[model samples]
Target: MVKNLYMLPEGLPEPVEDGACDHLQGLALPSVTRPATSGGSVDLSELPGTAVVFFYPMTGKPEQPPMRGWNKIPGARGCTTQCCGFRDRYPEFQALGVSVYGVSAQPLADQKEAVERLRLPYPLLNDTDLKLAEALELPLFDYDGHRYIKRITLLVEGGVIRQVYYPVFPPHLNPTDVLAQLRS
Candidate 1:
């Protein structure tokens, strides 16, 4: 059977909260420049106003087979769904003057493909060098000899992180959750 990238499989394990991101709140974003699908590097620290950055492991392409044991890894699945969710709700964020971004350790080519395939309104930043991840001390996992950032979301304003969501489960709903927090 063909796998559906947009639907999370039933019985997918839920990721538990870890204190890895606890210290992130109220910290100034580091001056890490990452290549964006929009065609230029962005310094998270220099972004003005509110911004939402959701970090995922990687996005799987439809033409390729799923990563080995991908579904079994908690928070490893749903990159595409999460991206689509943000794409769908991008207008709301734009109206609120919030910039949205997706980050992953995936290469720029892969991220570009995902952005085009998903029709994402926001750019997906390439963290292949892990500059942003290391600077922020984001949690990471290694699988098949490759390092990937664990699912996490950050709400940043004026270059400082004001809120952090760790072990973000049911990834598709993460954007909604962020929106709620922003509206509150």
Candidate 2:
């Protein structure tokens, strides 16, 4: 049911292929500029070439009501795996002229902490409001006593979604899966 809702219409939409993820996905992400830890909500519509945006969950605190318990998500494992997978194989994507980026609801402080802790070479965007995730209309889990972004990956080209992955086991996101898709 969810997958069907997210399926592309045969191929990329003309307007999106014109350099936007707007038609392929929806207007949500295209209109919202998520404040990156580096400062700014990058316009996904103008993204050049192929790129990957990974979304995760966060539990913000008062001062930074957007800075608490982000790593608490189960999706973090899958996220980390996918992130490192990309990092390890980053050169491959670059060689192929693809850009790679990661997004999460964690605050910049927390994101920086994780990046430093993991020693990742790439920058991670902070999407604590879950706005980015919501903009994409991605499945979100909230019940019992937890809230987290379902592990998801988007293969975007010229700002349009070439492919999307959901129900991805964050802790064990098969890099090969992404590799094969990206290679395709």
- Candidate 2: 10-residue stretch with minimal lDDT: 1-10
The regions of model 1 sitting more than 4 angstroms off are none
Task: Give the TM-score comparing model 1 with the true structure, all chains together.
Answer: 0.98
RMSD of 1: 0.8
- Which candidate leads in TM-score? 1
Instruction: Put down candidate 2 lDDT per residue, 1-184, tens digits, no spaces.
Output: 1221111223221111112223444232365665554456576667887787766453222233322333343443334556667677777777777776777765678777666655566667766677767767666666335555665667787777777665455323445577788776
CA deviation > 4 Å runs, candidate 2? 1-29, 38-40, 58-76, 143-146, 170-173
Predictions in order: lDDT: 0.93, 0.57
Candidate 1 lDDT, 31-82, residue by residue in tens: 9899999998899999999999999999888878767788898889998999
**Lowest summed-lDDT stretch of 10 residues in model 1?**
61-70
Record all residue pairs in model 2 with backbone atoms less than 3 Å apart, i.e. clashing. 20-159, 21-159, 59-68, 60-67, 61-65, 78-170, 78-171, 104-127, 105-127, 105-128
